[model samples]
Target: MSQAPQTAQQPVILTGDRPTGPLHLGHFVGSLRSRVELQHTHRQHVLLADTQAMTDNAHDPDKVRRNVLEVALDYLAVGIDPALTTIAVQSHLPALAELTLLYLNFVTVARLERNPTIKEEIHARGFGRDIPAGFLCYPVAQAADITGFKAQVVPVGEDQAPLIEQTNEIVRRINRQVDAELLPEAQALIPEMGRLPGIDGKAKMSKSLGNSIPLSSTADEITHAVKQMYTDPNHLRASDPGTVEGNVVFTYLDVFDPRKEEVEALKDHYRRGGLGDMVVKRRLEEVLQNLLAPIRERRTQLAADPGYVFGILREGTRKSQDITQATLDEVRGALGTFSFDRS
Candidate 1:
C-alpha cells in the first residue's frame, strides 16, 4: 500500500517499495503499474523505502545497499518517468523524521499495539511472541511519511485498507490534539487486482517467502520460476478433476493474461480434468513471457546505466525536500513547536 495523500485537484500520491531485493512481477501489478498510470493523472512521489527496510533488516546493510539502485532501475525501466514522477529516498526526507517525533505523542502505546498491520506483520514474522520497538513504532513513521507530504490518495490493495485507516486516524488526531488543521487526511486507491499471489501459492507473493518472480529475472529465470509454480495439489492424475481457485497458475493467468475468453476456457478445461498441469503451466509461461518481455528488456538497458538511475533518485529527493520543508514549517507553527519561544 502507498502512503501517498490524495488531493482534490490532482492529489499527490506517495508510494514506494523496499530495497531488500530486485523488483518482482508482484511489484508491477500491485503498485508500480498504477504508479505509472497515476503520473499523468495526479502528482506522484515514489519513495524507495530503505529506511523502513532497516526496521527489521537493520543488521543487513549489504543486502539493502545492493538492491537500492536495482529498485530505482526497475522504476524507470517500467516507465515511471522521472520528469513526471518525484522519486525520493525515504531517509533523505528529514521532515518525515521530524513529523514522526510529534506524531509519537498523539498515539498511545496501546494504540500502536492495536494496529492490525503491525499485528499481522508480527505474526507473519513469528515476532508475535516478541516485537521490536522500531517495528511497532514505524507505523507512526509511515503516518509522518503520508502527512509530511500532505498526500490525498494512496494506492493500495483491499487487504491493506487498515493501514489507510491508521493514516487517517493519525491525521485527524493530530489536527484535533493541536487544535488546528496542520495535516491533510488521506484515502486509498485500491486497484481491481488487489494482491498478487506467490509462485508457491502461499497467499501473497513476497520475497521472504521465496515465492516471488523478481523483475530483474532473466528469460531463463522466468522460465525456471514458472516451470516450478504450484498448481492444484489434489489433482495428481492427468484426468483428475482439478481446481484453479487457489492454484497459483490460474491465479497468475487471471491477472497477467488479458485474453479473458481463452483463460476462462483453460480454467474450465482444468476443472473438467482434461487439461494437464504441464500444459497450463506452459501456457502461463508464454503469457508471462509476453507480458514481461518489454519490462525485462527495459530493465537490462537501465542496469547498464546505473549512474543515471541514481541520478533520478537524487533529483527526486531534491524535489520532495522543497515541498516537505514547507509542510514542516506550517505544522510547527500550528502547534507552537516552532521557535520564537520566549521563555
Candidate 2:
C-alpha cells in the first residue's frame, strides 16, 4: 500500500522477543546481537514482550514472570545496552494495549487466521480445540507495538515478513478509517542470514520444542549440546559420506562462524566421508564459547545488580509512556474518546 522504506536517516527500529524463557543462541544469532549494533545507529526500542507471552501462557503466569528477568538478562547479556535502547515491558505500556483495542476493529478474525506466523505457532504449540482469545488477537497487539512507537524498521526473520505486511495493512486501514496518518507503515529488515534452525534440525529453535541452546549455558552444557548436535543424520560412521546441504550444524556455522573458508573446508571433508560429527561439533562449541564468553561474563556482572535491570525497565517504560500517551491522545481524538473532568 506504501513504498517500502528503502532507507531513512537513522530510522527508528522496534523489535523484541516474547519473554517465554531464557533467550537462547537462536535469539542472539537471529536478532538480539543485531539490535546491539543497530542501537547506535537507529532509534531502537527493545520490548520485553510480557503481554504477548501471556497470550499463550496465560494459565502459567509464574512461567512468564520467571522468564521476564531471564529475557532482560539475555538482552543485557547479548549487549543491548539500555542506554542506547528503550527496553520496556509490553503490559506496562497502556498505549500499546489501547492501540491494540482500536486496531482489532479493523482486522477480521479470518485475516488473523491467514497470518502465517500465528498459524505456524498454533500448529507448533498444538492448541487445537481451545485456542485462547488472547492468542488469536496477538497480531493486533503486535501492530500496537510497532505503531505505538511509530517505528519504521522492524527487523524480521524471513518467515516473519507476513507480520510486517499485516502491520502495514493496519496502517493503511487506520489512516483511511481515521482520516489521519496516525500510524506509520513499517518495513521488514530481513538480515542477510535468516533464522538459524534448531540443533535438532527442526525448522526453528524454540523453547517449547526444547532445541534451543541457552545463552547462559555452561561450557560442558555447550559441549554436550554440540556433541549431540545433528549433522548429516544418515552419515553413520566417519567413512560414510555426509551431507551439509540441510544439516543444522552447518546452518549454525553459516550464521555464527565468520571463517567461511573453514566452514567450506569442513563441508567438503564431510561430503568426502572423512569428517566426524564430533570434529565439527567441537569446532562449533569453540566458536560458540568465544561468542558467548563475553555475554556470560557481562551477565554475571550485571546479575550482581538486580536493581539496575529493573531500573532500566522502569526508566524505559516512563520514557515510552510519554510518547505513547501523546499518540493515544491523537488516536482517541480521532475516535472522540478524549475528554477531561475539569468541572
Candidate 3:
C-alpha cells in the first residue's frame, strides 16, 4: 500500500501520532516502523500532534500534555532517532494555527464535512450533530502541519488519504490563487498493514474503545490481553473446527509473526480441529512478547531520563519552528497586507 513519489533525491516526510494516550501496536505496525526506516533515506519530521488531539479532547488539556512525553518515549523506544527525524510538538508551532486560519478560506464547511476521515472519526466519537468546530476544521490544521514543513511525503494509513488529498487541494488552490507554488503537495505513503483491528474483533483498534494493547504494556499485560482476545465464537470446543478469517488472534499473528509457515501451519491445524484456543493464544502471546520486549526495555530506560526525552522534543520544536516560520513568511507575503508574526 506504500506509495512514494518518484524523485531523484529524498523527499521531506511529515508523519505523527495524536498524543492523547500511549501509542499501541496499531501505531507500531501502521507508521512507527516505516518512520524509523524512512528517516535514513528521507528528511523526516514526526509530530506529537497534541493540537489535533485537542480537537476532540479539548476538555482534558493536562491529559494531552502528559501523553506528549509518553508518545515521545514510544517513538524513541521504537528507534525513531531525533537526530535523523525532527520530533516536534504540534502546539508549540504557532505558525500552524495561523496557516490553518488562512487555509480555511480556501475550503468550505461542506467540503470539510465531506472529508471521509473527519466524517468517520466524528461517527466513531459519537459526536453526531454536536461535532466541535475545532474537530471539523482539523483538516486545515493538518494541511498546515504538512505544508509548514514543505513535506513531500506523508506516511499514513489508507483511511487518512482524504486528509492528504484535502491538504493537496488546499495547496493547489493556494498556488493557483497566488500564481506561485508556495507549498508542496504531500503524497500519502500508506503502509502494507494499513489498519489493525481491535483485540475485541472491532474494525479498528482504538484507545477509547479499550481494545488496544499499548506499546508500553508489560509482559503480564500483553499475556492478559492476548488471553482475552476474540477468536471464532462458534468454535466452542478444542475438537471443533475453527475459522481464522475474522479471528483477531490469527489476524495479529499474521501481522506480527515472522514465521509465516508456522502461522499458516497453525491455521491449518486449527481449521482441521484439535488446535485449541489456548494453544493459539499462547503462541500469539509469545510472538507479541518477543516483538515488544525490547521496545518495552528501551522505553523503561528512556523513561528514567525524562530530561533527555523532553530535551530532544524542545530542540526539535525549535528546528520545526524555524521551518514553519519560513513557510508562514511565504504564505503571508503571497496574501499581501496580512501580518501574523511569530514574535
Full-model lDDT for every candidate: 0.84, 0.85, 0.92
Best by lDDT: 3
Candidate 2 collision pairs = none
Worst 10 residues of 1 by lDDT: 1-10
Better of 1 and 2 by TM-score: 1
Candidate with better TM-score, 2 vs 3: 3
Question: lDDT of candidate 1?
Answer: 0.84
1-343 per-residue lDDT for model 3 (tens digits) = 2334324487899999889899999889888988878888888899999999999888999999999999999999999988788999999999999899989999999999999999898998899899999999999999999999999998877788999999999999989888988788999887887689999999889898999999999999999999999999999999999999999999999999999999999999999999999999999999999999999999999999999999999999999999898898898888674565532
Best by TM-score: 3
Q: Model 2 over residues 149-207: C-alpha lDDT tens digits?
A: 88999998888889899999989997887788777899999987666788788877877
RMSD per candidate (Å) reads: 3.4, 4.2, 3.4
Candidate 1 per-residue lDDT over residues 1-343, each given as its tens digit: 3534444478788888778898888889988888888987788888888888888888797788888888898888888888778889988889888888888988889988998878888887887666778889888888888887888888877766777788889889878978887777888888877778899887778887899998777789889999889999899987999998999999999888889899999989899998899999898899888878888898898888888888888899998888888888788877777476522
Q: Poorest 10 consecutive residues of model 2 by lDDT?
A: 1-10
Candidate 3 global lDDT: 0.92
What is the number of backbone collisions in each predicted candidate, taken in the order shown?
9, 0, 0
Candidate 2 — what's its lDDT? 0.85
**RMSD of model 3, in Å?**
3.4
